[model samples]
Target: MVTGLKPEKMAYYKQLHAHAWPGVLKKIKECNIRNYSIYIQKIEGKYFLFSYFEYVGSDFKGDMAKMAADTTTRRWWKETDPTQIPLPEAAAHKQQWQIMDEVFHTE
Candidate 1:
């Protein structure tokens, strides 16, 4: 699941993420993240993203650490991070974005 982001910054965010940088994509794959897509709702200017992947690799933490340590990933984040509002658990700071409780789910 993704988090809510402001509408005004939507286009810039979308454009950047539309074609994720090669390095960034490589880093994500290394981290076991795949089949990711983000969606925007105009009525309330909210953002949503969905990702699915197989966690076959054992070192989840190590993979994440490696991804975070990448210079290219850092640079990509610099551009798109501002446009995102991560949930509480994922937020860099408390005020950045509030985590929403899931009320429903269907498979």
Candidate 2:
């Protein structure tokens, strides 16, 4: 997934994730998401965030629903969402993270 970072909010964003809430992390694991990672880059004066995770759940939608239903996750999103700027596709889809198709992967 991809999202733009607000330059002014970068510090807060990093600080929050540096010690991410345990409950949020637990919920993500409970939803069968693994190998989660986020990377940041600066290009053309803009900061972008790229996240990758492997989903190992039989019911993707159900897992997502479970994550959404977690109060702690909701609170976490509230703190983090304002630090990002959704891309056009993500905005159109009403999503903070824009899902990207895998073009190449080995292993």
Candidate 3:
């Protein structure tokens, strides 16, 4: 997560994430992404979310492609994409999620 949603929108955002969308959650599981969680720090009424997920599948690219091709996933992105801040590269095109580097992992 980049920045906090507006005060009025925060509640709705929290509500939706409380029980993530079924289709989106299902697609994540299908892609072998597990032990996923998002942490938030609130400062001056602003929220910042740090998310982490384990990738258990062998073919990351293939799985991502499969997820991207899903209609449900596309629709889900449509709903949440507007709320997110894309990186400069991502902003130049249609990217639902951006890749992040893994600095360190114990296991």
Candidate 4:
């Protein structure tokens, strides 16, 4: 998934992730999501964040709901969501991250 980052909030965003909340991290593991990573890049004078993760759970939807219901996760989003700038299409639907289609993968 991808989202644009506010230039002004770039440092703060990285700082927040540097010492991520322990409870939130615990919840993410409990939800069966692993190998998660986020990368930032400057593209055409704009900053964007790309996030990747592997879901090891059977029920993706249910696991997501479970994560969403976690108080710690909700709290983490409160601090991080404001640092993002959703793309036009995603903003139209009130979403923060835009889903990226996987065109090719080899393991």
Write one digit per residue (lDDT tens) for candidate 1, span 62-92. 9868987999999997887687667667676
Per-residue lDDT over 23-98 for candidate 3, one digit per residue giving the tens place of the 0 to 100 score: 9999999999999886566778665555788889999999989998999888876766565555556456655345
Q: Model 4, 1-107: lDDT tens per residue?
A: 99999999999999999999999999999999999999999999999999999999999999999999998899999999999999988899999999999999999
Q: Which residue segments of model 4 deviate by more than 4 Å?
A: none
- Leading candidate by lDDT: 2
Clashing pairs for predicted structure model 1, backbone only: none
Worst 10 residues of 1 by lDDT: 43-52
Instruction: Assess candidate 3 and give its lDDT.
Output: 0.71
Each candidate: what lDDT?
0.69, 0.97, 0.71, 0.96
Model 3: residue 57 alpha-carbon error in angstroms: 0.9
Cα-based TM-score, every candidate: 0.69, 0.98, 0.74, 0.96
The deviation in Å at residue 31 for candidate 3 is 0.9
Q: Candidate 2 at residue 10, lDDT?
A: 97
Weakest 10 consecutive residues, lDDT, candidate 4? 88-97
Instruction: Sort the candidates on lDDT, descending order.
Output: 2, 4, 3, 1
Clashes of each: 0, 0, 0, 0
Q: Which lDDT tens digits does candidate 2 get at residues 5-68?
A: 9999999999999999999999999999999999999999999999999999999999999999
